[model samples]
Target: MTTPRRFDGRRALVTGGSRGIGEGIARRLAAEGAHVIVAGRSLGPAQEVAGEIGGSAVQMDISDAEATMAAVAALGPLDVLVNNAGFDDFAYFTDTAPQQWRALLGTNLEGMFACTHAALPAMQQAGYGRILNIGSEAGRIGSKGNAVYATTKAGIIGFSKSIARENARYGITCNTLAVGPIDTPLTDAARAVPVHGEKMVQAMKDGTLLRRLGTTEEVGAAAAFLCAEEASFVTAECLGVSGGMGISA
Candidate 1:
C-alpha cells in the first residue's frame, strides 16, 4: 500500500500562508508534493513557514492589486491558487465605519479577485487550474456583529461561482471553501472582544454539531481534497469546511 502524493509536479501559492489556516493549507499541499509558495504581508513569518515546509515565500499585501499581481506574476506559472489571505473584526453595522468596511472588502473580497484575475491567465494558457477561496460560515448564516465581514465572504461565493462558470471550459475550477469558526488568530481576536468573547465561543460550540471549534489542520485536509485531481469535476460550488454549521454558503 502507498499513500497518495496528490499534488506532485504542481505549483501552488497560498496567500496569508505565514500562519494559522493559510499555513496549514500550505503545509498540506507541500506535503502532497506541490511546489508551494507561502505568500503574505509579513515577510519573516512567511519565510519561516516556507522554510519549514520546504517551500518559497513572498511578501504580498493582497489588498493592493498592483503589488499582489506583481508578486503573483513573479511566481511565473501556478497550478493552484488558494486565496486564503483575509482579515476581520467584529462590529455592529451601526458602529461600522466606511473605512472599516472598505478595508474589510479590500482584503476579503478585492484581494481574492485580484489574485484570481492574475493567476487565471496562466492557468488558462495551460488549460489547467485550481482556485480555492476561503470563505466563512458567517456569510451563509450571518454573524451578529460581523456583517461587513459576512458581506465580503458572501461576495466571495458569488464571485467564485461566476468565475467558475466563465473558466470551467478552460479546465479551471473555481470553488469556495466556506469555513466555520476555526481556531485561527483572526477568530481568536474576534472572540476576545470585551463584550462577546465568551458568548461567541459558547455559541460556536453550541451551534456546531462537532461541539468544538475546527482546527487549521481540518481546514487544510478539506481544502486539499478539493484541490486534488479527484475533484476535477467539482466547480461553481461552495464546500463547507464547517462542522455541520450550515448546509451551504
Candidate 2:
C-alpha cells in the first residue's frame, strides 16, 4: 500500500532528529512527502538521518537559548515544529540536585519555550502551522525516580495549551503527545544494567495495559496524525500514545 502525502510541499523541523523517537518522526514525515529538517546537537548523526530521508540537517542545541532562537529563526517559514529534544535522568526528588534540575529544565522546558517562540513568527506570518510537543505519561501519573523530568513534561502540556490559545487566530495548532515507555536507545541503555534493568523494564511493561513497551514507530505514527493538516481542529489537546499505561489512572 502507498502512503498518503498529507504533507506534500510542507516543511517540518524536528529537534533531536538524530535518533530514537525524533528520528522516527522525521522518517515518517519524510515518507509522507514533507521536507524535513533534522536538527540535533551533533552534525554527523543529524546529517545521516537527513541523508536517508532526503532532507536537510541543522545543528541546534535547544538548551542554548540564543543559539536555538537563531537557528530556528533562520529556518524561514516553517509549517511544522516538533519539540522533541529533551533530557532525562532517574532520581528521586529528594536525591536530585539543583544542577540536575537545571539540566533537565533547561533542555526540556526552557528549550521548548525558545524554539516555539522562534518558530511562531514564521508560522504566524504564513497563517498556518502545526506544533507538536513530546510529553510523557510520567507527567500525568508521576514517576518514582523521574520527578524533575516529569515536571518538565507537565510544563509542556500547559505551554502547548497556551500557545494553542494564543495562536489559533493565526491558524496555528499546538498539541502535545503524552508518551509512555518506548523502545529507544535510552531505554536500551537503561535495560542493559544487570538486575535493576530487568526489574525496571518489567515494571514499565506491567504498568501498561498492553504488557509491553511502545515502539518509536508507534510514537511517530501518533505524532504524524496530530501534526497533520487533518488535525487542524485538534489544538490544545494532550493525546496519549502510551499503550494504555495510565488507562485506569
Candidate 3:
C-alpha cells in the first residue's frame, strides 16, 4: 500500500486526465494527498474526474502550442507534471496519410515540448520538480502497422532524457514510463470492431509474457513512483512497465 501523505501539499497537473490511464494517475495522486489538476481537451469529463477526486480541472489542448503554454502559465506553478496526452493511428507506414502523421505527432511528441517548456521555469525557480512522461512499449519495440505512434513514443524517451540531464542541477527530474497494453479508451475503440479487435486481443496475449493486458491503475502506480520524492535519483530513465513485453526489445 502507498504511504499516506506521500505527496502532501504538492500540486500535480496531468494532461489527458479526464479518463483512462490519465484519470487513473490523477486519482492515485489525489488519493496520496496531491492537489491534482485534471486537464484535458474538454471540460465535462475533466470536471467529472476532478469532482470525484476532489481535485481541479482545466480544459487545455496540449496539441495547441500557444494554448497549452498559456494554460500552464495560468496554473502559476506546479510541483509535478505528467505528460500523458497522446493519440495513435494504426496503419502501415506507406498507407499513413500526412494529416494523420501531423495530428499524431502534434499531440504525442510536440505536446510534451509545449507543456514541459512552460512548466520547467517554475520548477527551476523552486529548485524541485517531478516530470513523469507516459510512453509506450510499442515505441521501444516497434509494432506492426504502428510506425508513427512508435516514432512519437520513442521521441518522448529521448526528449525526457535530455530534459533530465539539463535540469538535474535545478533539482527537476524528468523520466518516461513506457507502458504496456492497457484497457484505455483508445484501445477500447479498437477492440470494438470484431476483426481488428480479435487481432489486437491476440497480439496482447502473445506479446506480453504475462498473457494478459495491464490496468490503468498499474500504469498509475508507476507514474506515481517516478513522480514521488523516492524516485529523485531515478531520472533520465525509461522504465518499462510492459509486463515483460519489452524485455528484449
Candidate 4:
C-alpha cells in the first residue's frame, strides 16, 4: 500500500531539526510531500538533514527573538510549524542556579513564544495551519531532576491551548505532543553521566508501562497524524506519545 501524502503542497518549518526528535519530524513531513525547512542553531547539521530529505535549511536560534522573527518572516508563510527546539539539564531545583534556569526557560519556553508569535500572523492570514509544540510527559507528571524543564513543558500545554482558541476561527490548529523516554542523543548524553547515568535511564524505562525506551520514528508518526488535515477537528489538545508513562499497568 502507498503512504498517503497528507502534506503534498504544504510548507513546514521544524525548529531544532538538525537532530533527534526534531530531525525525525522533519523527515516524516518531507516523506509525506511537504517542503520542510530544517532550522537549527548550526547551519552545518541543518543543511545535512535538509540535503538528505530534499528540504531546505535555515539558521534560527529561537532563543534570540530578533533572529527568530527575521528568519520566519523570510520564509513568507508556513502551513506547519513545529516548535521542537528546546534545552534541558538533569538537576534538582535547589541545586540549579539562576543561569541554569534562564537557559532552560529561554529555549524551552520563551523560544516557543518567539517562534509562534512570528508564525501566527501568516498562518492566520492563510486561514489554515497546524502548529505542534513538542512537550514532555515530565510537564504533566513532574520529574524528580527536571523541575524547570517540567515547568516549561507545562507552560507549553497552556500556550498551545490558548493559541488553538485564538486561531480556531482562522482554521489553524495548535496542540502539544508530550513525549516520554525516547532514545535520542539527549537521552544518551544523560545516560553517559559518570555515576547516575545508567540508573537514570533504567528508572525512566521502569516508570513506563512499556518498560523500555521509545523511538524517534514513533514520535514522528504521532506528530504526522496530529498535523495532518484529517485532524482538523483536533486542537488545543495534549497528545501523549509516552510509552504509557505515568500510567499504572
Pick the lDDT winner.
4
Report the lDDT tens digits of candidate 2 across residue range 1-249: 777788899999999999999999999999999999999899999999999999999998888988899999998889999999996887568977999999999999989999999999989999999999999988889887789999999999999999999999999999999999899987786677565777777888899989899999899999999889999889999988888986854
Would you list the clashing residue pairs of candidate 4?
Answer: none
Model 3 accuracy (lDDT, Cα): 0.90
lDDT of 4 by residue, 1-249 (tens): 576799999999999999999999999999999999999899999999999999999998888887888889898899999999997798778989999988889999888998899999999998999999999999899988899999999999999999999999999999999999999998998798788889989998998888999998899999999999999999999988888894631
- Candidate 4 regions exceeding 4 Å error are none
RMSD after CA superposition, every candidate: 1.3, 1.2, 1.2, 1.3
Tens-digit lDDT string for candidate 3 (1-249): 545667999999999999989999999999899999999899999999999999999999988998899899899899999999888777779988899999999999889899999999999999999999989998899887789999999999999999999999999999999998888887876577556776976787689989888888898888889999878899999998878999997
lDDT of each: 0.90, 0.92, 0.90, 0.92
Per-residue lDDT of 1-249 in model 1, one digit per residue for the tens?
453699999999999999999999999999999989999798999999999989999999998988888778888989999999998878889988999998998889889888988899999999999999999888888888889999999999999999999998899998998899898898788778898888987797777888898999899999898888789999988988889998533
Give TM per candidate. 0.97, 0.97, 0.97, 0.97
Our model 1 lands, by Cα RMSD against the true structure, at: 1.3
**Candidate 2 residue pairs in backbone clash:** none
What candidate 1 gets wrong by more than 4 Å, as runs, is: 1-3
The superposed Cα distance between candidate 1 and the true structure at residue 88, in angstroms, equals 0.9
Error of 2 at 235 (Å): 0.6
